[model samples]
Target: MKYQDQLKRTLEFENTPTRIVSLVPSQTELLVDLGLESLIVGVTKFCIHPASLRKNKTVVGGTKQVHFDKIKNLNPDIILCNKEENTKEMILELEKIAPVHLSDIYNLDDALKLIDLYGKLFSVEKKSEALVSSLENKYKDFRHYIKDQEKLKVAYFIWKNPWMVAANTTFIDAMLRLNSFDNYFGNLERYPEVDLNTIKEDLDVILLSSEPYPFKSADIKELRSRFLRTKVVLVDGEFFSWYGSRLDYAFAYFKTLHQDLSD
Candidate 1:
């Protein structure tokens, strides 16, 4: 079978991949949900969903760094990765071991496309189609609920120390738009760093994500002190960023969050 990755690279395989290794955390969970749990021989340390996966499989490494020896031992027929989560160097190295399918998702359409492709690749077309339908329906419902709500100018903070935010040309920004939040940093490049003070004047709400940097309530208090007029809320990073199976619940989370912001 011949398949092309999101990077526009074409790859072929002799047969259906039985042994698989997934480097991206969200994709790992998607594989399990697609009923490829037993076939998934290896996953990164960050593939925390199905929590049992960690206890069962060998941890190859993180998103950017991988243990080549561990993956080689797994003898995977196919390896899964994401353009943003895994580095070019890592994907190149993994290609030598097995055919790699890289998913690049920027919006809901791209995400649905990836899920559909995964179904075809794994021969679980029915399941993937069903999941996508469910997500589409939920998203429609959420949009209807917020149809009358005013769009809020939001600043979604993803990292600290450098003080970076989810800007334009990124999945997080796409998710923010779906929730009817106008990303204040949307005009800028992806994940740009900026002084918080410079953006405070335009932001109606400041969202602190709970991953990569793990912003807590304390962090919200700190930001609230600085931006007294803005509404500060701690958001689940997975809901806003993870573009795989986790998206199944993201709209539901967004509904609750929308209500919170409205209040």
Candidate 2:
């Protein structure tokens, strides 16, 4: 069978892939949720969602730095990756070992498409369809809930030190828009670095993500004092950024975040 990935790469498989290696954490969790657990022989160290898989599955290393030897020993029939998470050089290298399926997600629709593609690739179409339907229903409900609410101008910070943020062309920005948050940095292109002093005044809310930096309550306090005009809050990065099965609960989480802020 021949399949085309989101990156337009051609993946040729003899049959449904039995030995699977997932390099992206979110996609690894999606494969498990799709009931392909036994087939996933290896995963990156960051694929820690199911928890049990971390103990059982062979660790192939992190998103950007994969141990090719470990993956080679697993003998994966299909290796899953994401363009944003894994490097192109690594994808080219993994191609030598097995068929690589690369996913490129920008918005909610693209995420759903990736889920649908995985279902066909793994022969779990029924499960995938149900999951997609459920996600769509939840999103519809969320859209209705936020229909009358004011769109809060938000600045979502993903990293510190150099101070980077989720720009217009990223999945995080798309999720923000879906949840009725107006991204203040939407005009910017990719994940761009900026000075905190320049952006503190333009936002209604300053969201600090839990991953890639692990922003906490203490960090929020410091920022809140400095950026007094903006409401500083800590958000679960997975809900906003993990474009996979995690989305099933993302809308609910977004609702809770709004309720808490209103209180």
Candidate 3:
């Protein structure tokens, strides 16, 4: 069968891929949810969704770098990746071992497209359709729920040392928008470092993410001290950034967040 990746690269497979290597953590979890876990021969160190997934599978490395030798040894029939998660240099090298299927997701539509593609690619059309239908229903309901909710101006902090934020043109920003949270730095592109001295204090909320930097209670306290008027909270980074099966629970989480803010 002939298939095209999000990057517009064409790939062909004579039979359903029995051996798969997923480099993106979210994509790995999505593959598992699509009933492709048994076929996953390798995954990156960050693919800790099932928690026990990496125990049996070969750890091919991280998002930016990979162990080419280990992946070549596993002999994956296909390598799954994401444009934002994996680097171009790494993708070029991964292609030499196996056909690479790439996904570029920025919003709900892009994520659903990837899910639908996986369903068709792996011949799990029913499962994919069911998942997509469920997600669409939840998304519609969530949108309705937020229609009347106050749009709180929020700044999502992803890193600490450099003080970086989600900014615009990112999956995190899309998730924040879904929650009806207005990004204070919407004018900026991608994740950009900001000067703490110049940060506005009139913001409604300051969110510290729990991944890539692991913001904890201490960080929230510190931020709260600095931004006395704004509500400072720690949020699950996966829900805001990881776009896939995890999204099945993200809307629910967003509802809780909305309720908390309202209270």
Candidate 4:
């Protein structure tokens, strides 16, 4: 079968891939969902979605650093990666070993496209269609639920130390807009370092994600002290940031979050 990857390179695979190495954690989980687990030979340490797989699979390395020797030992027929998650230098290095399929995702549409692509790659069309249909229904319901509500001006913080925020070009920002929340920092290009003092006091809400920097309950209190008028909410980072199967739960979580803010 001839297949073209996100990079627009076409290749032929005579049979189903027997040995696959996934570098991106989210893509790893998506591959497992597509029922390509038996074919997966290596995964990064961060690929901890299906906890059972974590215990059994060989850990290649983290997102930025990979054990090339370990990867060579696996002798994978195919490798999956992401443009944003994995560095270009690393992708170039991996391409030297095997055909690397890289994905670039920035919105929910891209997420669905990836799922469809994986489905075609793995010959799991039924499963992929089912998942996509479910997600579509959830998204539609959420959109309808929020159509009548007032859009809240929100600031979604992803990191600390430098104080970075999700900008308009990101998947998180798309998700926020879909949920009827206006991103205060959407004008910025990417995740930019934001100054709290510069943020308007009239901002409706401030959301602290639970990953990357892992914002905790105490962090919310601290933020609240500075932005007393804004509702500081702790959000599951996976639901907002992870562009994999976790998106299935994001709509429900958003519904509850919207309700919480309404109260």
lDDT of each: 0.90, 0.92, 0.92, 0.88
Pull out the clashing pairs in model 2: none
Give me candidate 1's TM-score against the actual structure.
Answer: 0.98
By lDDT rank, best first, the candidates go: 3, 2, 1, 4
Error of 2 at 7 (Å): 1.6
Q: Which lDDT tens digits does candidate 1 get at residues 40-110?
A: 99999999999899999989999999999999999999999999999999989998998899999999999
lDDT of 2 at 224: 83
lDDT of 2 by residue, 107-146 (tens): 9999999999999999999999999999999999999998
TM-score of each: 0.98, 0.98, 0.98, 0.96
**Candidate whose lDDT is highest:** 3
255, model 2: CA deviation in Å?
Answer: 0.5
Off by over 4 Å in 3: none
Q: For all the candidates, what are their Cα RMSDs to the real structure?
A: 1.0, 0.9, 0.8, 1.2
